[model samples]
Target: MTRSWIGRRAVVAATFLLALSPLAPAAAAPPVVEAAGAALRPAGAEVVAVTKVAERLTDLSVRSPALGGRVVKVRLLTPDGWNPADRRQHWPSFWLLAGCCGDYTAWSGTDIAKIESLRKVLVVMPEAGWNGWYSNWWNHGAGGDPAWETFHTVELRRLLEKDWGASSNRVVAGLSMGGQGALLYAARHPGMFRAAAAYSASAHPLLNTESINRIMGFFGGQGGDPRRVWGDPVAQRNIWAAHDPYYLAHHLKSLPLYLSSGDGTAGPFDQPDALEADFNRQNKALAAALTQAGAKRLTTNFYGPGTHAWPYWQRELHSSLPILLTALNVRP
Candidate 1:
């Protein structure tokens, strides 16, 4: 490890390694490898350790007791003007959630890092399991690896606010599945975020039987028990409803909301993403519900020519970010 890893990440790596091979001597180094599960995370320990991934990027791992003490990772994109050596000023936060089948790195290489070229805030991207859906699982009513909602809204927020100098003012956004997460978290937490944005979000799971099955199928791919996530559509509709943005839009009346999607048509960017088009419909449907509820601070652009690909999402993030940044009072 270099002098750079001397920061949070290095300390964490050393701590875990020590916990794993306590009897080994420092002179006889153990193979630096990841533990099979939570082998490195002992019980009753809560620590958020940071490791450098790049010049301005860091990988933060937290001991999550909620997920059975599994160490969770969240990648942070520090501001261009950020100086770790300086502790006087704090950065407002912008949390970018990734879609299904994507990890924390999904938001990388996009124009998001340039949202405010002045780099006025910290950008945090937490990993919700590939098919996690960013929801606390029903697990046949035994709500439990991936209690993503608890991880992000509570555990992660506290770690960042206390240790990372993250300000209370914040915004959240995501694309596709993550788009739904942005809306769900904002609504569920009520005042945790000042604003929320979702692009091509899976805004409605109960829109139809087929939509329901399709989402359940994705959840199935993630675990042995698909029904464990939210249970039967008819039987556990409340659980599904709780995770659905359309049903929860009323809770967002006071929030600054940005919703957008295309008709899944071929645009100048690329051909249609079938999944994107499908979810675009979901987004449109959710928009209608929100509108009916008269969500006061809503902004939308239901463009009909794009798909569920990164180009459109990147463009959307760049376009709608002013709304979020302005709400966070960090607009550059």
Candidate 2:
């Protein structure tokens, strides 16, 4: 037999043997290739599956190393003409975070998907655990697994920008627990988001005893040990202060910010007598601190009569869109 023919037969035989070998290294496989031949690098976090929920919405099941190799779902609301297969085109990103007990579907469950102004933007809603608090758990200072901050800001951010066609320009908005998350992210990661907005958020959880106590209650929810989050409020005061937006106001002074909250009383959306929400006071404290820190472009809509609810948050979303889109250089 000729040398070339013998070589071809040997290669085919090796391929067949490798396919049947039980000791094959499947975990060491190369990157995933898209329909358009774009390769998704299997680095930190990677999307393993995709589901098209609607004409505009696509769900990505990402395997995250930050979350200890746990798989998480991230929903994307793609703009008109957005195609993951097309690597040449990219769009600005809008990160909409969920509250304490909510999931990634919170924003999608609302009417945000129908907004016409967002026709050219990509919305990213990630699953930040039921009580993740947008933080890397202190875990008594070991600081491992359930590192939400690392997952969202590092792994997921790179994955989206590289494979999902998201550009560097981004804006963020959230309500309640998510509101706190938005502020923390913006203040902690300077220049990451063009603008940020918070509606009835726990902005100054370390502002006073009331705020601290209330948040401690939240940290202990879902039967989770409160100490696992940020450690003892007294022992880990530095950690608490680090995550508190009030303490990080200086970091946000240069960015465009939108802050809004109600006095907790009944308004257009609530019944005759709605109890005042503690977050109103917390948000006010945050606004004052931001202003003191020289936030020139800050917008305050402390619309006195409302309470913490979806109707008000929905209204604030529309109200803050102008600022967010303006920062994005998009027409509102």
Candidate 3:
């Protein structure tokens, strides 16, 4: 009986030892973690997770130091034969930024993922925050945290180029607030984009008081302090001008540009009672500024009877693709 008890104890001990053996098969890492660690992280950022949402759509949750160590989502509409694990492959990138209240998924929420003309390029749609304005928040002159500009242009750009298959050749397009971002990024960083397009953009917000008030209203959205973004417009006039695309027109003269907008009237895509959009005059002013600044490769579609809506922006996207793709040296 004692020997029987000893044998039972020995059996249990052997089973426990076998379970701890180094030769035992280890548990596999989560697919998301494996994918996140597949590539080298950018200097101040790391991809925390990756989700394959669909056939060609991937959502990367990145932890950004520029954004105060916040984790944000960035959607990738990958091209055919593109592989994140393969470092040798690089495709031209199309940055489709979202508007003030929208997230990174805004463009994919449209039919852009199905557009065949965009199949050959890597479409990077990053979260610019709700009312992020695509600018580093002034934060009362402290100048840190929630730095959208550095997050996008520096950390995210480097990550995509190093890990994901994004080439140096790039084009940018957006609507509304994002349209402003598209233009600002191109102008602020010379040679960053091959071409730029904006639809129904608040192009010249510094043109007058009405425009200034309108944007200040946007700045005050979602319980945010208007002063946190760029400070008092009166006090921070230089900062405001620095971010205004109209004021930066001279910097954009060399790149291919596509500017299109509606007169804010009811058009084919709008209801009969659609109110006029206030951005028409802004677009017109920006177009003139670009031309006057010696922009030779500019295209303006200011289609007369439209409104600032998705239908018009979608159409404008299709219309501008030829120029965008041409600038990227990709066939439409």
Candidate 4:
């Protein structure tokens, strides 16, 4: 009996050891990390209730078989009668602009979708990778730098137009840094977009190095030189001037332009109060420069008791929605 007990104990010990062994691969995890305070997030802006036209209208990322290394994540909003197979008449589309540190979800996550439902247009939110600046990079020689212009104008646009059936004529707009990108891109490629808007844009990057440094730090990495992306303000004067939307004042006259900035004094990025004052002054200077440069097709607004926040952006969109819709000839 004692010998039997010993054998049974040995067997139990061996089983325990095997259980502790690290032979198995780890379990797979869900793709997205649920952010803190996300549980209480409310449904975004309101739209007319319609059957969900597409499968799982949520955050999705796709690698381009066409564009090679380009990986794009989109928060897509398909309208009531969307058909991927049918190449029917295209519907008007608005590309949702993402702020610095934002992905494609900014529009759908906020009250943007609710507001968008009021308009009869498709809204596409593309993940313009964190700090991509919407400009293709120079030093990224690996899978290669992001071909943002081509991706937006050619690759993704083609896929969206073919599969989703959005209109060929489009409008683009965004908040803060995205605002800067939208305006700059529209100015550079006048024929690509019909109307554009920027809310609290870091527009006057030419006048100050501090804002440029922030942008450079976001995209080029800490201590990385800015010249590779934007070039030196002094040495590469022409390149810098070309990027400044205000400097490209003649281009602004042709495209529908809307610009807005709150007094930065009460914003999140502001510090020590005095610094916010300086930023507000700089943005004001940019607006003044635009006005002086004979910008005709332009509408500028400076809101009171406001700061650079999603709430302010949401409100601004409400005001701009009618104007943009009218400009695009979409009925209210």
Residue 190 lDDT (model 4): 59
The superposed Cα distance between candidate 4 and the true structure at residue 259, in angstroms, equals 0.8
Residue-wise lDDT of candidate 1 within 12-128, one digit each (tens)? 232222112100000111112211121222234255577998867888888876576678788888987776556665788999998877788888767665555427788989888
Which residues of candidate 1, in runs, are more than 4 Å off? 1-45, 80-88, 140-144
* TM-score pick, better of 1 and 2: 2
TM-scores of the candidates are: 0.81, 0.84, 0.84, 0.73
RMSD of each candidate relative to the true structure: 15.2, 18.6, 20.7, 18.6
Candidate 4 per-residue lDDT, tens place, 35-73, comes to: 212222111212122234344254435554333455567
lDDT by residue (tens digit), candidate 3, 85-129: 999999999999887667788777578888997899999999998
TM-score of 2: 0.84
Prediction 1 TM-score vs. true: 0.81
lDDT of 2 by residue, 175-262 (tens): 8878889988888777789999998788987765545555665666655566678666666677787888888888888999999988
Runs of candidate 3 with Cα error greater than 4 angstroms are 1-42, 140-145, 271-276
Give me the overall lDDT of model 1. Answer: 0.71
